[model samples]
Every structure is written in C-alpha cells, then in structure tokens.
Target chain A: MVLLLVAPAVAAGIVLLLPSARAIMRFCAMGTITTATVAACCAWRTFAGGSLQAGEWFRMDMLSAWHLVLMAGVFSAVSLYAVGYFSKELESGAFSRGKAARYAALWFGAMDAMTVVLLTDNLGVMWVGIEATTLLTAFMILTHSSPASLEAMWKYLLMCSVGVALAFIGVILAAASAESAGLTGAQVLSWTHLLDAAGSLSSAHVKMAFIFAVVGYGTKAGLAPMHSWLPDAHSQAPAPVSAMFSAFMLNAALYCVLRSLALVEAVTGSDGWGREVLLVLGLVSVLLAAVFIVGQRDIKRLLAYSSVEHIGLIAVGIGLGGAGAAAALLHAMNHSVAKTLSFMSAGRIGQAYGTNDMRRISGALHAEPLWGTGLLLGIMMLAGMAPFGIFLSEFLILKSALEGGRYLLAGALLAGLVAVFVGVMRHAIGVSWGAHEGIVRNVGAGWLDRFLVAGAILVSLVLGIWPCSRLWHVLEMASALTGGMP
Target chain B: MMPLVDSVHVLILVTCLLLLGSSRLGACIRTVAIQGIVAGGVLPWVSSLHISMQLLFTGVFVMALKGIVFPVLLSRAMREASASREMSPFVGYGTSLMAGVLFFLASLWLGAKLPTPDGVSGLAVPTACMMVSTGLFLIIARRLAVTQVIGYIVVENGIYALGLAVAHDIPVLVELGAMLDAFVAVFVMGIAIFHINREFDHMDSGRLNVLKG
Candidate 1:
C-alpha cells in the first residue's frame, strides 16, 4: 500500500530532476506506473482476505482495494497512450524535451495524489489529495499552454478549488459529528474513528454536512446544474488528461461522496433520503448530457457529454441499491474502459485532422483507419449497444429500479439514455465515415495505441458477457461499502 | 460586557460589509488583510482546548498568512493585471450594500435555526454564514478574475470560522495542511492571473467569453 502511493511521488521527483531526455523520462514513468499497478492489483485480488491497515493514516478495505484497482487500470492505459501522445507532440515540435519532462512529472503527481485519495483513512488528507489534483492537473491541462487552455485551466482551478472548499465544510461538519460521539483531537477527522461512531453522530449535522458535500463534490463529479465547467475543461484539456479526468478523476470525487453518504446513511439509519437525492441528480445529469450531445461540434466535447451521461447512469445505479449498487460498480468499471478508449481515439483523430471539430474533420477512417474504427467502435459501445458492459450495466440499473418499485425513474433513465444513443451515434458515424477536407498531419495510430484501445474495449466486453467469479465477489464487496446496498 | 471574541466577530462582519460595497481593489485587499489580522483574535480564550503554545502559533501564523502574505500576492497580481480599481461592478455598490445587509439578516435567521452542539460559542455560526454569503456574492458580483480570487479567499475564511464552531481541537497537522493548501491554491491562481494578463492585455474575465457553449 505504501509502495503504491510512494512509487508515483518518487517517480515525479526523479522525472522533474532528470536531464531533459524524453525517453529516459518516459521509461521512468512507465516503470513506476507498472510498479503501482501491480501492487494495486495484488491488493485487489487479496482484498477479501482483509484490509491492509497502515496505522491510522491509510487503509485498503474492499472498497478502496477495488477503486485502487480501477484507478490503476486507467493509469496504466493512459501512461501507455501518453508515450504515443508525446511522441506525436515531440515530432510536431509542440513539446520541447524540457516541457515533455515536466509533463511527465505533473502526470505522476496527479497519479500520486489520486492514489492518496483512494487509500487515505484520514478525510482531511483526502481533501488535500483532491485539492492537489486540481493544482497538478491545472498544470497538465495546458502542457502547451494556449490562451484557450489557460482559460480552461483558470475556470477549472477556481471552480474546483471553491467546490473543494465547500467540501471542507462538509469535512468539518463530519468531524463535528464525531465531537457529539465523544471523539476528539485527531480522531475527530479520522475516517475509522468516525465510521466506528457513525451510528451515534448527530443526525442534523450529518444531514447539513451532506448537502454541502453533494453540491461541492458534485461540482467536481460534474453532476449537472453544477456541470458548467465539464465540457470546457474536458474539451480543451490534452487528450490523455481528458481520459484521466473522465475515467478516474470524477470517480475520485464520487468516491468521496460515497464515503460521506455511507456515514450519513449509517447515522440516519437508512431512511432512503440519500438514495432518492442521488436518483434525481443522476437522472438530471443524463437528461442534460442528452441535450448537450446533440449540438456538440468538438468531438472531445461530445465524448465529454457522454461521460456525463455514463456517470449519471452509474449514479442512478448506486441510488437504486440492492442489485443497483453492484450494477453501479460494474458500470463504473465498464465506463472507465470504454470512455478511455473513446477519449484516446478522439485524441488520435484530432491529431490526424489537427482540429477537434467533427464537422471540419471528416473521413477519419479514410485517413487514420485504426483510430477511426476505434472511435466508431467506442461510440457503438458508449451508446449502450448490445453485448457491451455499459448496456448490461444500464439494463441492470433499470431492472433494479423496477425491482425497487421506482418505475418512473427507470422510465426517465431509459428515455434519456436512448436519446443520447441516437444523437451520439449520428455524430460519431458522420465523423468516422467521411473524407476530411483538411490536411491530415498525424501518422496513423501505432500498434501499441491500437492494442490499448482494443484491449480496453475487450475488457468492457468480457465484463458484460461473462464477468469472472472473482470480479463478482469484488463487486459485492465494493457495493457493500455504500449505504445503497441492502 | 461583551467578550473580546464577540468584538472580533463584529469586525469580521464589518469587513465583509465594507468589502461588499467597495469598488477599489486595493481597499478591498486591505480590508481582507485587516479581517485576517482580526480573525487572529478568535483564538485567545485562556481555557484552551489544546496546548496554548500551539494555539498561539496557529493564531500568529494565520494572521501572518492572511494579513500580510496573501495581500502581497494579490496586490502583485493586481499590478501585473494593471487594472487598479474595479472599474465596473456586476452588482453596483448601492445594491451590493443592500445585499450585504440582507446577507447578515439571512445568516442571523439561519443561524438562529441551526442545531448548535453543546458548549459552542454562539457567534461562530452566524459570523461564518455571513462571511460565506458575502464571499459568494463577491465572486458572482465581480467581473475581474483577481477579485474573484479574493472572493475565494473570503470563502475560505468563512469555512475556517465554521470549523472553529464545530470540530474544536482539529488536529494541528490537518489545520496547517488545510492552510498550506489554501496558500498554494492562491499562489497557483496568482500565476495563472499573471498569464491571463500576458495573453490578453487585461484580466477581465468578461473578455473570456470566447469559449462559451
């Protein structure tokens, strides 16, 4: 567990201090990410044995273990894709060697910070981890800082920082609830202590705390109404960062919400209020994403909206509980796999055409066939096409909703998803099939790039059709971490 | 006779009122500085939950960071951005002042209704609430990016005040960590503001209307 956190931070420091040799830096980054990934996977496999409790500062329970596995999964893929990404950027002279080295370092910093969030037993440190990612990724968002990227970074930093500050209020209130439970000093802010005393914590404070938590962290999670920053930041961020943001960053934010929700429900005795609120917000996010996807010109923005929709679906599933909770975990895993593929493919397609505008850059398959096909396939799965995990996951959520007697919510979710499916397919198909009028600059996707994308899609498919037995047990454990579970 | 802490709380509220109606960026910065210094006064009760030594260190440290350090960063950002004075207020002075009063009234009403835990200082909740309302209003009601950053600082102060009411004896390590993160957040934003100045001759976020949906 310690190694999983330290490897990335150490990599970041070494990457920063190295002479500006891109290959050396890339090699270092890959080595550290591989170490972290293997360690995390080991933890995940053995999680049912018991949690790895490291003092009071960090722990890896079944919940953290699974999230750690998923976070590392995305990191591994993004790290591989980044090699191809930076190679293209270097060839284009967009990243001088120094700039590339700095990029490598910041990438690791973000990875380290998020790893901390997943593993921390101290909510205060978790808040710091989340805030640090905002800062680290602010730099990453504009590796080759342009005016637009700067604007995006500015909005992201300010909005997320403010949102996170509100989350601090939630943290304080949670700790205060501990005060009522007769805990004090450091134990007040410690997750283990709070969880142990959760049943006796003040209900009013917990309820008040969660409202700010939902709004504050919800902004970070890109739940609609508070999601104004999502499209701009996601669209303008460099492609790999977009992949990280969608695949794991929002999940990190949502992870905090889950931690808070579990406590709230524990204190309030599972009265169902928390789940209902999540249901409303989740459906609203889907509806908003469906509306946004229809008119998006930027392909990255289009994928960004799809992420919002997918996250909404996951939220709804979590909201439904019982089977819904398991389904939500499965859905998050599925979405991360597919969304990473979609973003990376869009990156390549954008590179090939030198613009993200879908209308302007047509005939992607004609030029960069590998990525174009990947993009089309990614969209096919994202639109919840048959045999895809996302489809299965969404179907399970609807099934859970019906089983829970939430037919109206199930109907609304179905409608919103179908609307997005049609609109995204139309846009994706148009971009993939046509001949782009503009000059194509990027060399076609390399073997490694194609393998990563295909592997991601393959993982999603396997999870859909025949999820391994171990994975089902892991899902059960993950679902049990939340209050939504029966 | 009112306790010294009560007077300090009043000053914090007054600073918010003064900031809400004031258009001069420099004055707003100074007012925040004074508020920062005054907020140090909140820490001095002799019974002392934790070690008095640690409390003294925290008070002086917060006073220095909020009073002196942040103001320097902001003023530097203000100068580089080269727009001294707000020039335009999204919510004008007269209306903003009205909102400030309303913010106070609302905080009072809400504070009255909030469930306070046993033995908490009564003024903490209402003071924190007013600070939050004024800060959010400051963020929305301003056009310049720099002022918005200041609004964020104001919001942090409010959160800090709320932290005091609940969670007494917050771990010194976590408290310092939070403060350090706030400093870094401000520093990062300050650098970005400098770039915003370089990219466009002015830091008017209104000009940032280009990337709209």
Candidate 2:
C-alpha cells in the first residue's frame, strides 16, 4: 500500500536523474510494473482478510483493496503503453525529449496521488489527494500546445476546481455536522468516528453534505450536467493518458462518492433519496451519452462519451442498492479493464491512421489486426456483449432492478444500454471492417501492447465465465465495508 | 477588533458586488484585491492571539501575497494581453451584481440556519460563505481569463477566511500550506493565461470554443 502511494514519487526522482527520454520511459515502465506487482500482492493479502491501517491518515480495507488493485493494474498498463507511445513520438520528433520526460514524471505523480486517494481513510486528506491528481493531470492533458488542447485543459481545470471547491464545502459541512453532534477535535471529521456516531449527526446537514459531495465528485466522475469538460479533455489528451483517465480516474472519483454514500446511508438509513439522486444522474448520463455518441466524429470523443455511459451504469447500479451495489462494484472493475483495452487500442489505431476522426479511418482489421481486434472486442465488451464480465455485471444490475420492482427503471436502462450498443457497434464496425482505403503504415507493435490487450481480454473473459473464490471473498468484504448487501 | 472583522465582512460583500458590476478588467482586479485585503485583515482579528511573532509574520505574508503579489501579477498579465475591458459576458454586469447580492443573502441565511462549530466567530462563517460564492459567481460570469483568475483568488481568500473563523487549534503549518497552495494556484493561472494569450491571441475565455462535442 505504501509502495502504491510512493511509487510515482520514486519514479519521478529516478526519471529526473535519467539523462535521456528513453531511459526515463524505461524507468517509469519498470517502476509502474513493480508497483502493480506490489499492489496485487497487497490486494491478495487484504483479500485473505488482512488489514493495515497507517495511523488515522490511511487504511487499506477491503474496499480500498479492490480499488488499489484496479488502479495499479490499469496504471501499469498505461505506463507501459505510454513508454511505447512516447518513444515513437520521440523518435518521430513530435515533441522534445524534455517534454516527454516531464510528461512521464507527471504521469507517475498522478498515479501516486490517485493511489493516495484510494488508500487514505481521512476525508480531508482524500480531498487533498484528489486535488493533487487534478493539478498533476491537468498539465498532462495539455501536453500539446494546440489551442483546442489549451481550451480543453482550461475547461478541465476551471470546472474541476470549482467542483472540488464545492466538495470542500461539503467536507466542511460534514465536519460541522459532526461538531453539531457534540463530537470534537479530529473525531469530528474521521470517517470511522462519523459512522460510529451516525445517529447523532444531523440528517438534514448530512443530506446537504452528500448533495454537495455528489455534485462535486460526480463532476469528476463525468456525470451529466457537470460532464461538459470531460469529452474535450479526454479527446484532446494523448491516448495513454486518455486510457488512464477513463480506466481508473473516473473510478477514483466514484470511490470518493461511494465513501460519502456509505456515511450518508448510515446517517439517513434506507430513505433511498440518495439512491434516487444517483439513479436520476445515472439515467441522464446514459441517455445523454447515447445521443452524443451517435453524432461523435472523433473516435476519442466517442470513447469519452462511452466512459460517461459506463460511469452512469455504475452509478445506477449503486443506486439500486442491495445486490445492485455488488454488481456495480464488479462492473467498475470490469469496465476499467475493458475501457483501458479499448482506449489503448484506439490510441494505436489513431496513430496508425494518423487521425482520430472516424470518417478518415476505415478497415482497421485489414490495417492492423491486433489493434483492430482489440478495439472490436473491447467495444463489444463495453457494449455488454455476452461472455464478457461487463455483460454479466450489467445483467446482474438488470436482475437486481427487476427484483427490486424498479421495472420502469430497468426498462429505461435496457433501452439506454441498447442505444449505446447500437451506436458503438456502428462505429466499431465502420472502423474495423470494409475495404482499406487509407494508407496503412506499419508501426511495429510492442510486447506491452500485446500484454495489455491479451491480459485485459483474459481477465474479462475469466470473470465472465467463472467467479473465483478470492474475488467473491473480496467483494463480500467490500460490500460489508460499504454497508451494502453482497 | 471584532467590529473591524464585522466591517471587513461588509467590505468584502461590497467588493464582491463591485466586482460583478464592473466591466473593466482592471477594475475587477482592483475589487478582488480589496476583497483580499479585507479577508486578510479579518484573519488576525478572528484569531485568539492579539499579537505574536508568528501571527504578525503570517499577516504580513497574507498582505503581501494576497493583496500585493497576486493583484500585481494579474495586472501585468492584463497589460501584456492589452485587453482592458470585458465587452460582454454570458450575463450582464447589472444582473451579475444582483446575483451577487442574492448569493450573499443566501449565504447569510445558510449560516444562520446551521449550528456554528466551536471557536467560530458569529460573523466569519456567513462572511466567508458569501465571499466564496461571490468569487465563484465572478469566475462564472466574467469573460476574460485574467479576471476569472482574480475571481479564483477571491474564492481562495474566502476559504482562508473560513479557516480563520474555525482556527481554534488548527496548526499554523496547515494554514501556511493552504496559503502557499492558493498562491501557487494563482501563479500557475497567471502562466496559463499568458500561454492562452500567446496561443489564442486573446485572453477572453468566451473565444475558446474550438473543442465542442
């Protein structure tokens, strides 16, 4: 867990010492892989029911353990993909080595900051971590000096900064609410203590606090109304960075929301108002994403909207409560893996075609088989096709909704999912099949690319077919920690 | 001292209104600076210690950074950009001023409704909330990037004011960290504005609409 928090800092230090961009890329790749290994081991230990608490500042419980594993795994793949991507850019002289080195350093820094957000139990410190990630990644999004990139970066910064400020207000209010309950000192803001003293905390204050936090973090999670900046940022950013943003950063923000949800649920009992809010936001996000994806010209922007859709689905799952929360948690993991694969494949395809515009690119299968295959399979999985983990989790979500007698909601969700499937499949088929018209240049594929594509596909497939006892145990423990049914 | 702190709140409220009412970027920057000074002035008054070496030094830093350093940085950037006036905003200045008034009143109402945390001054919470929201409103309403940055600084000042209100046993280092982070955020914003001006040939964020979906 400590390694997860500090790996990026260590990588940054080493990268700073490296003389060349190639060396920096190699170091980052190695460092992130090591971090991923450590995180996996930590997750295993935590899954075996081992717990570690670093004072009151940080804790690795079952919930955080799952997030840690996902974050490390996704970031590791992104780092390796970045190495290949940046090296190509460097060799082609697209950017200076110095800029590439700086990007690598900040990339690891962002990973480290996000790791802290996952591991830390303190709400204030978690805000700090999230804020730090924002600062770090905002620059990464603007690696290029285009006007569009700058605008996207600024929009990202301003909107997220405002959103985070509101979140801080929520934190202050939560602390204030706890103080109103006669709790004093550090106990007033501690998550554990707040849960213990939930009955004493004012429900009205808690409700207000949750509203602000959900809006604030929900902005980061790419929920609608506040999701205006996401498409621009994700599409404008480099591909590997885009992968990281979709695959894990959104999940990190969702984790913060879930944490607050736990507190809010404890205080308000099963009032379901919070769940209703989540459901509303979720459905809106899906419907909006489906509409936008249909007209999306840029492949990256299409993927970005897909992220909004997936996040919406996860939110809806969480809102359904009971078994839905478990399904959502599982969906979160599956989506991260599948989305990373999708973005990485998209990045490679975008590079090969020399454009991200779907209109300009065609016959990706004939052009680059591995990338084309990856994009096809990944999108199919994201669209919730059978035999993928997303399919299973999404099915479970529908089952839970029906079981809960939310048939109308289940119907709407199914409609949205189907709309998304049609939209994405249309684009994917258009991009992946047919005659190759564009000049296809062979950009030599790397081992890392194969590893990511194969590994993600294998994981999704295995999770779809069989549920490992270890994963089940971890999910059970996580559900308990979240105060939801497993 | 208490009266001065209360009056500072009123001054901040007025400055926030003036900011929304102003069309000129220079005037907006000036209004924000004055708001910052009022915010800095209230900090020492809210603290328990009347006089101390550390407190005195912090006040000096606040005055220098928030009052002098930030405004100057913003002014220089505006001068370099050579865009003095904000022609039109998403919302007109008069409407924004009205919105600012509503925000202040709403904040006051919110403060009155909530139970105060221990050691928090009666005046500070509402004042801080008002200042924060006003700052947010300015950022949203203002067209020019530089003015929006000034608005961000004003919001940070309000957050600092909240920190002062609830200081109690809050460590000086944490306060310093927050201050330093705010300073850096504005500093980075200044650099970003410069880059924006150079790239886009205008600091008006209204013109930055190339990446729409």
Candidate 3:
C-alpha cells in the first residue's frame, strides 16, 4: 500500500533525473504510472470482496477501493495518451525538451497526490493531499504561461485553496463530532472510528460538518455556483492535464464527500437529511451546466460544463441512495472513461487548428480523421446517446428516481439532459463537419493516440452494451459503503 | 475569560466590515493581518479545554503563518503588482459595507439556531459566519486579484475560528498540516499574482474575461 503511494514519487524522481530523450523520459514516467495502476487494480480486486485494510495513517475500504480503481484506470489512459500528446507538440517544436520534462514530472506528481487523497484515513491529511494536487496542477495549467494561463492558474489556486480551507474546517468539525463521543487523535479523523462512534457523536456538529463537507468539497468537485474555476482551468491547461483534472480530480473530491456522507448517514441512522443536500445541489449543478452548455463557445469550456453536469448527475444518483448510488458510481466510472477520450481528442484537434474556438474549427475529419472521429464519438457518448455506458448509467438514475416516486426531480433531470444533449451534439458536429480550413493539419493524432482513444471508446461501448457483472458487483458494494443498498 | 473571547470575536467582525468597505489594497491586507493576530490571540483563551502542547503548537503556527507570514507575502505581492488601490470595485465599498451588516444579522440569527456548546464564547459561531461571508463578499465585490487573495485568507481565518470553537481536540498534526497547506496555497497564489501583474500589467481580475461564456 505504501508502495502505491511512493511508486509515482519514485518514478517522478527518476524521470526528473533521466537524460531528456523525449521517448526515454516519457516511457519511464509511463512505466511507473502503469505500475501504480497495476497495484491499485490488485488492491481494487481484493477489496471488492469487501475487506477493509488499515495502516497507521491510511485505510482502504469499499469506497476508496472503488475510486482507486476508477482513478488508476483514468490515470493510466491519460498517461498513455500524454505520450502521444507531448510527442506531437515536441515534433512540431511547440514544446522544448525542458518544458516536456516539467510536464512529465508534474503529471506524475499530480497522480501521486490524488492517490494520497484516496488512501488517507485521516480527513485532514486528505485535505493536504487535495491542496497538494491544486499546487501541482496549478503549474501544469500554466505550462505555456500565457497571460490567460496565468490567470487560470491564479483563480484555480485561490478558489480551490479557499474551498479546501473550508474543507479543513469540515474535517475539524468531523473530528470534534467524534471527540465529543470521546475518540481522540487519529481516531477523531479516522473514518472507521467515526463510524463506530457515530451514534454518540453530536448530531448537530456532524450535521454542520457534513454541510461544510458538501459545499467545500463540492466546490472542489466543480459543483455549480462554485464551479467558476473549472472552465478556465480546464481550457487553459494542456489537454492531458485537463483530462486528468476533469476525469479524476473532481471524482476524488466527491469521494471525500461520500466519506463524510457515510458518517453523516450513520449518525442520523438513515440517508434522509444529508442526501437531500446532495440531491438539491446535484439538480442545481445539472441545470446550471445545461444553461452554460447552450452558450459555450470554447470547445474545452463546453466539455468542462458537460463535466459539471455529469458530476451533478452522479451526485443525484448517490443522493437518491439504494440503486441510485450504484448507478452514480457506474456513471462516475463511465464519465471518467468517456471524458478522458473527449479531452484528448479535443486537445489533438485544438493543436491542429491552433485554436480551441468552436467557431474557428470545422471539417476536422477532413483534416485529422482519427482525432475527429474520437471527438465525435466521445461527445456523443457523453451526451448520453445510446450504445454508451453514460446513457445506461443516466437511465438507471432516472429509473431509480421514478421508481422511488421522485417525479418532479426525474422530470427536471430529463429535461436538462435533453437540452444538453441537443446542444452538445450540435456543437460537436459543428466542429467535426461544419465549415473552415485548419492550419496544422493531421499532425496531432499519431497511432498511439488513435489506439488509446479507440480503447477508451470501446470500453464505454462495452460497458453500455453489456457491462461486466463483476464491475457491477464492485460498484454495488462500493455504494453500500455509503449507506446505499444494492 | 469569555469576555476576552467575545472581544476577539467583535474585533473579527469589525475587520470583516473594514475589509468589505475598504478599497485600498494595502489596508485590506493589513486588516487581514490584524484579523489573523486577533484570531490567533483568542485561540489560547477561547477554548474551555486546558491548553495542551498540541494547542500551543497550533496557536504559534497559525499566528506565524496567518498573522505574520501571509500578510508579508501578500503585501509584497501587492507591491510587485504595482497597483495600490482597486480602481473601481464591482460592488462599491458603501454597498458592500451594507452587505456586511446584513451578513452579521444573518449570522446572529443562525448562531441563535445552532445551540452553542457550554464553555465556548457565544459569539464564535456568529463571528466566524460573518467573517466567511465578508471574505466571500470581498472575493465577489473586489476587482483586484490581490484583494481576492486577501479575501481567501479572511475566509480561512473564519474557518479557523470555527475550528477553534468546535474542534479543540483536532490532532496537532492535522492542525499544523492544515496551516501548512494554507500557507503554501497563499504562497502559490502570491506567485501567480506576480505573474498576472507582470503579464497583463494590471491586477484587475475583471479584465480577465477572456475565457467567459
């Protein structure tokens, strides 16, 4: 378990020390991330049997294990695609060797920090890990240091830091709640300890902690009204980093929320109070993203808004509990795979066009066939079109809602989904087949990119057509940890 | 003892209003510094629990970082940004001060609803809530990046006070770890401010409308 944490740091150190052959350095970085992914997968498979493992400072349970697998899968894919991304940039003289080195180093660093966030049993340490991700990736967003990139980095740092500071207070409150029941030190912030003492914990203090947890971590998760930082940071960042940010970072924050939700639910002895908060916030985020998606002009910004919507849906799924939690976890998994593909393809397309402006790009298929197809397929999948797991997960969420007799909630969610679907698919096609000449043609999507994008799409398609029963079982068990019964 | 804690809480609210009403960047940073010191000073006396080594450490760490280290870094960034005052705020100072008063009333009402634990100062929750709202107001109402950073620190101080009130048993390691994280966050933002100033030649986050919908 410790090696899972240290492997990336070790890899980053070696990558930093290696002579800067573009292929050599990237391969070394990829190799270590792959190792970490494998370790995480092993842990995931074992933990799926519902075993809980505890270290002195960290713990692995169903919730963390599920996210560990999802995060590792996304990180592995991004890293492989990143090789292609930076290679194209390098060949085109867009990135110097040193710049590429920094990207590789920080890429692994960000991965390491997120891994820590999932693994830490201590909520405060988890806050530190989230803060560390902010710092590590803030630089990643400023890889080019354009005035715009600098501004993005500034807002990302400030907003996330402030959000995270509030989260620390949440952690403190959580600790206080547990301590009022007489737990101390590590046990105060330890999830299992809090769980054990949930009944004796001050319900009001836990309630306060849970609200701050929702708002604070929700802010980091790109929840609406607090999602002001997402679009800028996502758009300004390099595509691979943007992919990681969208795919894993937000999920990690929500994973923190889920940890607190379990505590809150146990204390209250049901899912009524805190889950309502999640449901309402989830609905607001969906509506907010739907409205923004209609007026979005930047391609990355569009994808970013879509991310907010997907995150919201996942929130709603978990908030609904029972089957909804299972669906939400599945949706998180599906969104991770689909969204990474979109960002990678978008990055490729943007590089080829020298712009991310939707109006400025068209006929991407005519310019770069592989990336263009990936972009189209990825967006279609994300818009919850058929034959994609996103569609299935979303359907399950609405079904669970209707089954539970949440007609108004279901209706509002369906309406938002339809509006966003039309808007996103229209914008996606407008880029792939609309009208314009692109300058840097056909240079982006190398064979590696094609393979990775195809692999991601294939995964999404497979999950939709017939998801592995094993995967469903894992997600079900994971949801159960958060007071959901599958 | 409780009165001393109440004084600190009152002073924090005053700082919140000052920050909301002041347009001068330097004054806001200084006011945040003062808030930090007040917050740190109240820490030792406010907790009904006897001071432990962990409490002592958290006090010194927050004082050094929030009280002294952060303000110095923020002021230096202000100097480097070269803009000393917000040219025009989104919400003018007068209106923001009104918002501060309303936030105070709301916090008082909220504090009344959530029963305060015996032995803690009654004003802790209200002051913390007001400070958080004022910090958010500064972030939304001010135009300068530096002021936004100042607002962020204010918000953290508010959360810090809340932590002090409700969570004295928070492990020393977590407290120090959190303070360290906050310090590093401010440091990174300060560096970003320097870059934003140098690149755009101004500190106005309002003009950062390039990536808007």
Quantify all predictions' global Cα lDDT against the true fold.
0.83, 0.82, 0.84
DockQ winner between candidates 1 and 3? 1
Taking the candidates in order, what DockQ does each have? 0.76, 0.42, 0.70
For residues A1-486, write the lDDT of model 1, one tens digit per residue: 777788887777777667655674476547656866676775755565877787789887877777887887888888788888878877888877787777788888888889889889888988989998888899888887889988888888988998999998888888877877899877887777887898788887888888788878888888887777788889888888899999989988888888887878777777766777778888999999999898888899898888888878877887787778888988888888888988989998888788888888778888888888788888888999978888888888899999989889888888998899889988988998866785788566678887897898788889889899888777887787788465
- Please, what is the TM-score per model? 0.97, 0.95, 0.95
Order by lDDT, highest first = 3, 1, 2
Interface RMSD of predicted model 1:
1.1
| Regions of candidate 2 where Cα sits further than 4 Å from its true position | A483-486, B1-4, B40-44, B47-62, B117-124, B163-177
Share of native interface contacts recovered by each model = 0.72, 0.22, 0.81
Query: By the TM-score metric, which is better: model 1 or model 3?
Result: 1
True-structure Cα RMSD, model 1 = 1.7
Tell me how far the alpha carbon of residue A158 in candidate 2 is from the true structure, in angstroms, after superposition: 0.9
What iRMS does model 3 reach? 1.5
Give per-residue CA lDDT, model 3, range A346-392, as digits (tens).
Answer: 99899889899898989887777888888999999999988999999
Deviating ranges (above 4 Å) for candidate 1: B40-51
